[model samples]
Target: MNTTINMTGNWKPKLMIIGTLLGAGVGLVTASLLARAAEEGGDLELNGGDLLKTALGVVTTMRSVAALGAGIG
Candidate 1:
């Protein structure tokens, strides 16, 4: 009798790099939009508060997604 098995190696580095780039791109776009919104709001200002809130929201969402993917959620 004979048996054979095949397995694929992980592509974690490439996946990590892609994830990092995607996160960075999201952060950059979010910051730009928040700044633009703050500027257009005139006297109704956030003084970085809006930006901080947006950043926290993004982080929280990412963390939740990661946890769900890892079966922790």
Candidate 2:
């Protein structure tokens, strides 16, 4: 009795790695964009935009990888 959830084959780990890399790339790109703005005067304002962008990236990456996996399987 095989208890595997994936019917595509032994590609679970590889897919996971790809998903992780995708997420990281997205997050990094977002962060870089946010960093483009230089600090003004003396103090810099803190914002949640960067965090939100990274979260979006993670979600986007996951969805993309899931879609790819489904298509392949």
Candidate 3:
């Protein structure tokens, strides 16, 4: 008599889902802020006021994503 068994991998689905969620969240926040700033009825000047806030937001997103990737690695 002989017997056979089969197995499937689930790592791809799990990682894909997590990555999608994280990316979407970060992208959403960044896009919304950028759009609002652009629509605030004013000339575009990213070198003065509001620059810090914009920088912080982008840096924060990068840091979080980096941390997550580091942890995964």
Q: Specify the highest-TM-score model's number.
A: 1
Alpha carbon lDDT of each predicted model: 0.76, 0.69, 0.74
Pairs that collide, model 3: none
Q: Write one digit per residue (lDDT tens) for candidate 3, span 1-73.
A: 4433233678667878987898799879977887888889565556765778867987887788778656642
Q: List the residue pairs that clash in candidate 2.
A: none
CA deviation > 4 Å runs, candidate 2? 1-8, 39-73
Query: Residue 66 deviation, candidate 1, in Å?
Result: 1.8
Inter-residue clash pairs, candidate 1:
none
Which digits, one per residue and each the tens of the lDDT, describe model 2 over residues 1-73?
A: 4344554867878867976898699779866665665333444556799669867986887688678656652
Ranking by TM-score: 1, 2, 3
Residue 16 lDDT in model 2?
78
Candidate 3 displacement at residue 60 in angstroms: 11
**What would you estimate as the lDDT of candidate 1?**
0.76
C-alpha lDDT of candidate 2 relative to the true structure:
0.69
Choose 1 or 3, whichever is better by TM-score.
1
RMSD of 3: 10.1
Error of 2 at 65 (Å): 6.7
Q: Which candidate tops lDDT?
A: 1
